[model samples]
Structure formats: C-alpha cells, structure tokens
Target: MSLPPKTALITVGATAPFPALISASLAPAFLSTLSSLGYTHLLIQHGLTPTNFGGTPSGQSLLSSLTNLSTTSPLKITAFDFTPNLSSEIATSDLIISHAGSGSILEALRHVKRLVVVPNEDLMDNHQKELAGELEAQGYLIEGRVDNLPEAIKKAERATFKHFPRSGSEVFGRIVEEELGFEAEG
Candidate 1:
C-alpha cells in the first residue's frame, strides 16, 4: 500500500525576500531528500520581492520557472506570494521550513509543527541567525543553512521538538513573569 501524502511548507516571510532559501528548498537534492522522507508536496511562500539573484531570475519569476525544472523525485511543488490564511497552511503541513524571522518561527511553533529554520545570512544586523540558533539550542526547531538543507531535513525527520506554549496560556504568563521577576498577587 502506498503511504499517505505528506506536505512540507516553506515560508520566506512577506517583507524581505529570501532567494537563497527558496532556491535551496527547491533544489534537486533537497526535493529528493524530502521524497525519501515521505513528503510528497512542497508549498512555498516566496515573499514579495521582484529582485533577481546574482543575475539569475528570482522571486515570482523563479517560482514560475519551477514547472520546467526536472527532478527525479516526484515532489509536487507550488508557491504563492502572500496570504492571510498561512495558519491554515501550517496546520495542514507535516513539516515546515522557514526563514528565521520571529513571526514565522512563532507561527509554526504555535501550531506545534516540525520546523527547520534557515536564517537569511544576507540581511542587515544578522539577528535572524541569533534567533534560529537560540531556538535550535532550545530544541524547538532545527537550524539549517542554505547549503546544508539536505542534512537538516534528515535530522528533522527523526527529531522530536519541545511544545511551544500557546499565547495567553498560563504557562506562557508564568514563564514571562519568572523571567521578569514579577510576583503573582493572590
């Protein structure tokens, strides 16, 4: 019997476009890795930049070219620029690969999805790296680089993650209070 179809979602956020992450996620090696891991579909939120990457077409243009690209693996690929219903996509996905923006990270965590975070190294200040590193250190997600995504995918397949507390939950409140040294009043 065939295994049930599994979906992996990749989000690069809506403000700054991450061409490297998008390119890596769609690479033949990466798709093959996902296929071996039983993922049959790939959905990418490619963000809203029209810029090309080092003379190569990127952003919407790259996504348009995906149909002509050939891979040995039968991973179905699709992409969108932006959406208000990203939460629904996250809920349906068995795995998530995202740029290390805090909003994207938190959104995936809130859904308790298995996440692989790749911080865009080209961004100013490089804060995404710090956030991805901390989250990986905490066991909430796997931190991946553009060149090493295949390895990261292998790790994520066997990894178990810490449950992220829901917003406004008592656990979240307590953790915040403890961190801030605020005492609860009876």
Candidate 2:
C-alpha cells in the first residue's frame, strides 16, 4: 500500500493563485525542493499578511495570527484543503514544516512530529531563527533557514525520531493533585 505523503508544515507565504508572487515566507526554492522530494502534504499555518506581500507584512493572516498565517497557500494549494473540515486536516498531519514562531514551533513539537523549521529573516524574524537554531541543537527540528534548506531536509529525513518529553503536562497534574489532595482509590 502507498504511504501517505510526508507532511511538511509551512507557516508562511501568500497564496492567491498568483504564481508570479514569490511567497512572502514560502521560499520558492524550499517548496520546489519538497515537491521534488515527493512529499505530498505541506501542512501550513496561515501567517500574517505582509504590509506588502511581495516585500512586507500587511495584516493578520487570521484573527489571532496564531490560528492562521497571512498566507493563502493552504487555500490555493488544493492539497491540504481537501475537505471543508480544518480540524481533520491538522489532525492527520505526519510531518511539519513552518516558521520558527514560538507558538508555531511549540505546537509541532508538542505533537512529537518531525519538524522542518523555516525562519524568515527579511521580516526580521531573527528570534524565530534563534529558536530554530536552539531546537536544532537539541535535535528537535530540521533546519531550513534561508541558506541551508537542502541539507537540512536530508538530515530531517534521516533524523533519529526521538519522542520529546511531555514534561509539563505530567508535572502539572501532579501539582494539581497534591493541591487538591485527592485520595487514592481503595
């Protein structure tokens, strides 16, 4: 049986059926490479609009910016938007490729999915790059920064899939239980 296409979460770019429009954060070369690599599902988080799509961020992609990226890649791609149900699309993701926004990165890792983090420098998303770099150091994500996407994808493909600890949730429950002083089941 054929396996599902490897997913790469992209949390940047503008999709309006405008091919000439270079992706704001979509990185054409990166997208092209993934396509060549035979990955089918490119999981994308809608990003904020550039003040200028070609060269700037204009508006919030979604009301919360976190819910969606200013990009329309998800809408126009015809790949992920297969159904009207957004939750199903996100829930079935196997891989994730996206910007280094803190929340965005956290969500990908929380699910323990392999990640390809692409940070945008043009918009001064330096913090995102720093976060990606740190995660790479910890072996949490594959790096696809402006300069080194090709090799990063290769490495991600071969990365040792280790489960990131869900440390907080487990710890939090313990604290709550202790505070509430629940009795043990007899």
Candidate 3:
C-alpha cells in the first residue's frame, strides 16, 4: 500500500497590509504543477486580501477562485480568510509557504518545517525581504517571488533547514545587564 501525499500550508497574514503576491501568482497554473509534484492537500490562509486574482481579493472571491482552481487541479485546495487555530495549522502542515513576517518565520523554524517565504514587496519600507534573504542564505528557508513560485517549491524539496538557536528571557536579561547596565531582581 502507498502512503498518502504530504500537505502544504500557505499563509498570508491579515496584518501584513498587502496581498500575498506569491499565492496570487500560483493560482491559475502552478497549483496543478504542485499537485503533480505529490502534494495532496493545500490550505491557503488568504488573510484579508480583497480578491484572489491580481489585486487585493476579498475572501469570498478568493475562495471562489481557489474552488475553480481546485476543480482543474488534482490537489485538494482550501482557502480561508483566517484561522483562529493557526498553531494547529502550522503543526499539521508538512510544508509551509508564507509571507516573510517575523512571527511566521519563527514559528515555522521552531517547528523545523520546510518553509518558503514570499515577502510583500509592496509595503512601505518592508524589511521582510531582507529577513527572508538572510534566512535563505543560512539554508533555513527559500526566498521566492511571485513569478517563480514553482521553481521555489521544487527547490525547497531539497533545501536544508538549519536548526535555529532559541533565546529566552534569561539570555536577553544578561545581554541587557551587560549592554545597558540594567539588572533584574531574581
């Protein structure tokens, strides 16, 4: 008997202030390609994007588009505005495609999930690209673009994710004491 295919989660945060360009780019053609590459299910958290087309897509409209896309592709697709159980979603997914928000990056890294980051370059003074680039350089994630999402996904299958160091309050407190001469009472 053959095992089931892996699942992928793509999240574009509502607080991101811009649509997820990569997801938008993937809709018409690449979804089928992803399916052929062995992904069984794809869950897209569209956040507050107004439409799923080329611009800001409303959640309903995006879902409609995704539904249509799913009909044409073998991959089972689900698109939602947002999910309250984001941590649960993250934990369940085998691969993650996300906007380059710090929280998303950290969570995926913490879970050691295979990650692909598509930073929203539309935002004013967006630093997400830089962060994603740095992490990609360290082999922790793949930095992707709207125009080349399939290539990114193909590359991510073989990409290595390095273990990220965890920092805690005690470590931060020590740094503060040394750098700013501030001490916390134990």
Query: What are the Cα lDDT values of the candidates?
Result: 0.80, 0.52, 0.73
lDDT of 2 by residue, 1-186 (tens): 875566655544332222112243345555566666667655544434432333313343323332333253332232221234433444566666666555556666677776777766654425556656666776777867545665677677789765667883553344334434565455
State in Å the error of residue 89, model 2.
4.4
- In model 2, the runs with Cα more than 4 Å from the true position are 13-29, 50-52, 55-76, 79-90, 122-125, 168-186
Total residue pair clashes for candidate 3: 7
Output the TM-score of candidate 3: 0.80
Residue 26 error, candidate 1, Å = 1.7
In candidate 1, the residue pairs with backbone N, CA or C atoms under 3 Å apart (3 or more residues apart, or in different chains) clash, namely: none
TM-score of each: 0.83, 0.57, 0.80
Q: Which stretches of candidate 3 lie over 4 Å from their true place?
A: 20-26, 51-60, 168-186
Off by over 4 Å in 1: 51-61, 70-73, 167-186
- Highest TM-score among the candidates is held by which one? 1
